[model samples]
Target: MAAQHFRVLARDPNTRARLGELHLAHGTVATPVFMPIATQGTVKMLTADDLEALGAQMLLANAYHLHLRPGETLIAQLGGLHRFMGWQRPILTDSGGFQVFSLSTLREVTDEGVRFRSHHDGTDHFLHPETSIRIQEALGSDIAMVFDDVVAYPCPREQAQAAMERSLRWAERCRKAHRRPDQLLFAITHGGVYADLRRWCTERLVAMDFPGYAIGGLSVGEPKEQMFGMVALSTELLPDDKPRYLMGVGTPADIARAVALGVDMFDCVLPTRLGRTGTAFTAQGRLNLRNARYATALEPLDPTCDCVTCRRYSRAYLRHLFKAGEATGPRLLTYHNLHFYLRLMDRLRAAIVAGTVHQIVDEMTRLFPDEPSEREA
Candidate 1:
């Protein structure tokens, strides 16, 4: 009945990927699900109803953002993020580690935690592992990530090694500090792209016995091969029964590759973020509605997708809305993209259950030809 429980129904013949069900407080979420990021308590233009219709059962929010804006107590007093944001589905809140790291200009990291001035105002504050845990518990997310030191791209071996070692210690502190039985705690593995370091961190976190695991320190100007290699190697070390999450990952190609390496859960800002910019993800590839190519095109975003956007709106109409800056356009596209991810995971699970994941991946590779775009180009 707890969120941490995972029941594996099937496994891929060629890889560690498996079909499984996760028990969460809001409901049961199928494995390989994409939890869209909703920092500051909203998924931008889309509502909870739209997300529910799009088949999203779980989503992600951030403890760091909420702590800065409006504060956690305000959200809790207003009846937690679910009611405060009008989303009743399950939510997983990230610890402030990533955000703190991102505020490099305003911060100094010590063993106690990170101290920085709020990017909003000039007010100073601090967030340690226990403090992050307390903030997430106050926000009442169904799942919470451990506070780990996240290093930027191309960090030195000495710095990366130090952070990696400290992260293991922090994971234990977070595990010990976490008091919510309803909220599952997931330890994050952070070691840049080093094989030995990934192994060292994974082994240490696994020994701490967290309910779930995540692969972090990626998507920050690293090569795709390095990211994929870290994922492949780290997933190998995670416990087989626990859920494996690839944080901030959700490109169609990214999900496809990660699933093959046995990652069961993903949370990313890409879908909604790209959707806001009038781009859409398709089995074939990503598309930009802002393109003049869509001006007269009457087909749906994806001819194969059954989302409401595909069922109703034409590419021409969507392109017009994006150009015109209509609010609904981004909302509808976001819904469609979320639907595509949830449906893709559904298909992945079914293929695994049917013992044809290899064929499925091969078929997906054939349909979606382009690999992950490493750079903006």
Candidate 2:
């Protein structure tokens, strides 16, 4: 059977924020959801049970990384990605277009596809839209993103336009090439920071009428204001009935603001990556466990958090674990960080249903006053 459809349940009176559901082949996901990145079939140090316990409704994986490492054919023979990863919940597989552009040191882009060397072993690989669709089909993910041409931020308008046109053509190829009846394919909108280009791309994709749409090409070192503006514009042009995803974005603040702008889904590496480096996302903000001030501070990571790490461990102990180079430190922090992000999404969803989205947005903005540097996060 094909993946189920998206259902918008309630909309905020004040903002575009809405409470909805994305019915997938694996399960139904609550909207305004935050999908933890399991780029290589795992969320870093966490397990599937850990993800379920953290209230994760879905997960995001990469076709690029998985295709290179274990290869999709091997995974398909072993019962697809869900059984391979032990994650029975819904999974969204990215086409690796971003990875091909970002990770490959050597690449050539043609109207048909991208030819590049794998960053892992410098192995030669050619990825076209059809190849991406085929890989995701073999992986058997619940949702698949179309392969897109990603341009760097601050690119010339001409460059951005050319990439945008190419991405549109590629999206059509993905649409035609996709063969998995049980998986939903989502198209991505790209245009750098150019409004006209973004609108043009969105309009054309909407006309194609995929199951969902994702706003990509932002959050690549562009200013926060510019990114938000692009999100607003894209969401404004997208159909209200279909789910809208904001790709590779962002902090708690970024999620809240984007939700207000009508986004329904998000994914990022900040939580897991930061957690590994001794940082924890708290209700009060980010707390670095490596700081000396926490050397003797005996409080929980967050006074309000109920995660096992926060409930059973104190700041002092966590700090010690990191200082002592214990692997458990990163594991604990990763768990807590994912819990925080997932809980934040829960709060936002409830707020949308209760007509209190603005209040939650204000609170999140106050807690995360400034967006952390992407590299630092």
Candidate 3:
């Protein structure tokens, strides 16, 4: 029998969201959680201790990048991802299929796998389902993702269907290749924006009975409504017992809506990326630290925030750091942004238990109003 790694603890009567627990080899992570993206074994400017301090339960790393540089064999020799990165908490490794499709310059996709040149050094490389599983196993993360062909937004109907079917075939191979008892493997559902294809893929993945399911291919430049529609459709078809992960999604509004649709896990680089660019996520929309308006402001980034950045530094000081190109500016904002995401998750779980998710959602919408044109993460 497959391992039973997830358990629903509570449900919201007003919405599809539920409070759940994912029991992993490393530890237990509360559901509706936001995992910081630690791409290349690091979460940008923050340290492992900083992540823990920010209330992060687990983090996401890219197997593709790690495989290209340090190589998985070296990581295995160094005692795996957790020890190597000094993060003892649960870690989930993405199979890097997205990178194969999005990052590589020249690529060819075949039944065997994807053949591509490294974006870093233009070296020849190939990644199949079996090899992806092997790499994740070597990394020894608590959760591993199956490699799937991800099509970009505005894809043709025929091409979307073909990619979705191919992803299913690769999923089966990943299931057979995965031998680690400690690692829970997740299958990424791909179907572009086609509802029928999405349904077909979800039902098929459910039949395979992987420990979890991830909703992929949505945030690749699709409209907000279409993306949420895909998420809702996929969640409707997924088993309630297993966890659901929404990959590379979103702003606060996006996360809240996905949670209401019963998504259990989320990972995105938006917070750190925006932070590095002198932007901060706040309850009252985004704050631009580079703006001259902040130069004389003596307030914290967010008055309600309790993060060290908010507690210690004033807006003026943060602005000064950014204006002068000091590295500390990005580091401070990164910490605050991570804290905000984790705190948002904590509040969501509480709202689910209290059956007040709708209220929370409404508050988030009001606080973070959608702009006329918003970009995907």
Candidate 4:
């Protein structure tokens, strides 16, 4: 049997969407899955039990953060990320190339590797493809991403091409350096907003043939039309039998659109991030608990939601908590927001199977009135 395998169980006739299974070392992860971010080995404010309650099957962690903090060696000593975090399901770890470039200052990028100062302290650190693979292996995640040069949005075509070429070189090194047979190494496609360069990067990575693939370098301050165009082009070339992940993406509409383009996996911090700011996602649209409008509202955050927060509390009470500067406000909203995303994915998976993905997209459009205009291509 192959160490990593993806089998298509169903495909939508109208869209590129597919219902699939990702066979990994830890277990089988249902495709069209949403993996919440667990940056420091934990999905902030929510416990492992809370995750289980929400039916979360997988999560994403940052090897960069773990390696910088308690350290990957310590995590391995505690018996890998799964045991250390108490999450028995599949986990994917970013190679930290993005964080290094985005979060740190005084960085140098060469064909050999990237060197930058630690965001935690001012100390310098270097991360190359081989070192990234070693860090992920120590974490023992089910999936490890190749370290790639992620270029910022609106970059010059010349700079984009250079970044794409460098990413290709790094991917090859990661492919050769990855040692864990139990882990599936996935290559990331990078090329800013240039279609030709994006196509070139995808072709090169496909030739290298990593077990899985991720569409990176999107959602990086680019306009919606350009990002969707890139996603459409990237998905067109990626192998149908392998899982495709859209890294660090996005809103409900974003996920639905990517799924329509045949993406299988996603990870984002949007829900938790917004939840911390007293925002909640409802079927109608986003609701700000900080607003005085919800102060006397007796409705649940989302009448349709079955999450604990919705079942137990009202918008009035949640607004009161936030207005009063209570910590529980964020906690409750975070749980509900995660529940909303997971439930959205659940609906998407079902829609894929039912061959009604287009309908789901339209429904989400009506629900999020601001979305269609924003995602217009």
Candidate 5:
């Protein structure tokens, strides 16, 4: 049977901030949501159950890493990616384009696709748009991305424009090649700061008719203004019925600002990756669990948070675990950080639904205007 389709639930009275649902083969997802990075088909220390408990209805997986590690054929024979990963919720797989771009020596981009060396063992590999579609089909993700050329940070206008054009052409090829009706293919817009190129990509994709769209290659070491411009401009041009995803976006501040500008989905590695190094997100501000100031602190990670990390543990204990090289330290911090991000999304969704998204943004900024970066809760 065909799966259910995306539905618009609400829209902010004052802005483009919208509330919607993405129905997939696995389940439905709330819009304006943050997808935790499960790069290797796992969100670091989190299990599927943990994700559900935290209200996470979807997640993002990495094609390049999975292709290198487990090999695609194995996942296909093992009942596709769903059984291999044990995640029953909706999953989105990125085309290997961004990953190949990052591996400078190993990759060469052409009009057809990218040719590159495997980062794992210097093995040769090739990834084209149609090829990416085939791989994600084997992975059986609910949402798959088009293979796109990602310009490196600090690239020239002409270079960025060239990459965006390639990305748009690739997106058309991907949409035509895609075979899974159950899996939604989202085209990416890769214009760096060139509004004209961004508009071109958006206009082209809207014509190509992807089920959804993504704003890509923005936060690649560009200044905050450029990143926001990429998002705001792309969001302005995208169709209202489809979801707008901000690919590889940034910190809490970045998320808040992008959400305000009407982005519907976000995926980033900051929370889990930073958690391992003792960085955590709190309502007050960022916290480094390893800080000496937390040595004797007894407060919950965040006073208003109701997650397990806050409901049960203290800052001092978590600090001790991290200092003592215990695995529990990273686990606790990861849980707290993910919980915080997920909750932030929930609040934003609620605000959009309630016709008070702008008010929520104002209140959040006023309340957190800079949570004293203090060790105190």
Candidate 6:
């Protein structure tokens, strides 16, 4: 049913990279795309108009956060998340499994569901796989991820196997419970860095025949090589006709590498989060605007960036804004960082069409030479 919503148009000769399109209820989105995190229905310090201006194809929002705050019923009453957020493009709502699991000290996971205390008010709550599906359906996102059991990196083999099996069971529950025909439910594969477990999970999930698949339980403090290895295995096992999403992944280099491995969709909070902390992503590397060296620099944030922030504002002015604690400083940096990411996807897609995806990967590898840090990866 949901398979009719996506199609691959082109593929890279050298890699698994492909050019594709997601035909969603709201709008169409291109493959190898990076979705900006709009966790609370809005990207911090940015508006729907701003996101549109920045050329963001789709936004990633959290069902857990929105379910806790404002509630899903209210959003549905307000004409769903699209009208509620004033963004008419495609939106993907995470199953909230990660957020629930992140409260490790305050939560307990069982085959039935997860029982947890909200970080906001210490309130008690339970999220079943069925419950996650209902919440996402009420929110009315174009793509809804299945609720999965997420385990930390370096987890014991036995524990990883148990969690992976539980995630597959939950995926089955979500598939049966999802009722929104307009919204596509995606399955998430969880194997915690074990090649065999990853393959097992991927094979089983692919059999479920979801419209799309997301490689989850990664980018959670694992070594880059291990993460990529798992991703490679998962993507290889997943069906080529379906889109593969790498959840909560990555930097520019990470995106490039994942794209090469056959990932089609990605979402991360790095750009906005780093921007708020006075950091800017540039071709050369991350630039700390708080540094004294930038206080006298007159060039733009990234000389190659055509974003409004980079086109009009000088590095000295941006540093001054940050140093002076002006709110506009973070907004500008966030805009440009988003621009950089979206632009990177655009370039990759073009390369895929041009049969030169490796050129973009080479450029990204050169710009981001260091190994991915746990905090950012």
Task: Indicate which candidate wins on lDDT.
Answer: 2
Candidate 1: tens digits of C-alpha lDDT, residues 1-377: 23348877788888778888888766777897788778878777887778777777787898988988889999989988888888877899989788777753578888878888877777889778899999999899988999989887898988998998888888888988999888899999988888889998899888887788899888777887899899999888988888998877756667777888899998777677778889898866778898898999999999998889999999999999988889989998988888877888888888777766676667666756654432110
C-alpha lDDT of all candidate models, in order? 0.82, 0.92, 0.90, 0.89, 0.81, 0.90
The positional error of residue 267 in candidate 3, measured at the CA in angstroms, is 0.8
- Residues 179-248 of candidate 6: C-alpha lDDT, one tens digit per residue: 9999999999988989998998889988889999999999888888888899888888988889999988
Badly placed stretches (over 4 Å) of model 1 are: 1-4, 363-377
Model 6: how far residue 102 lies from native, Å: 1.1
Query: What is candidate 3's CA lDDT for residue 198?
Result: 91
* Residue-by-residue lDDT tens digits, candidate 4, 238-287: 98878999988788888898899999998888888889889899987899
lDDT of 1 at 149: 90
TM-score for each of the candidates: 0.94, 0.98, 0.97, 0.96, 0.94, 0.97
Candidate 2 residue runs with Cα over 4 Å from true position: 1-4, 372-377
Superposing all C-alpha atoms, what RMSD in Å does each candidate have to the true structure? 2.5, 1.7, 1.6, 2.7, 3.8, 1.4
**Candidate 2: clashing pairs of residues:** none
**Residue 112 displacement (Å), model 3:** 0.9
User: lDDT score, residue 357, model 1?
Assistant: 67
Global Cα lDDT for candidate 2: 0.92
Range of the 10 consecutive residues with the lowest summed lDDT in candidate 1: 368-377
Decoy 6 TM-score against native: 0.97
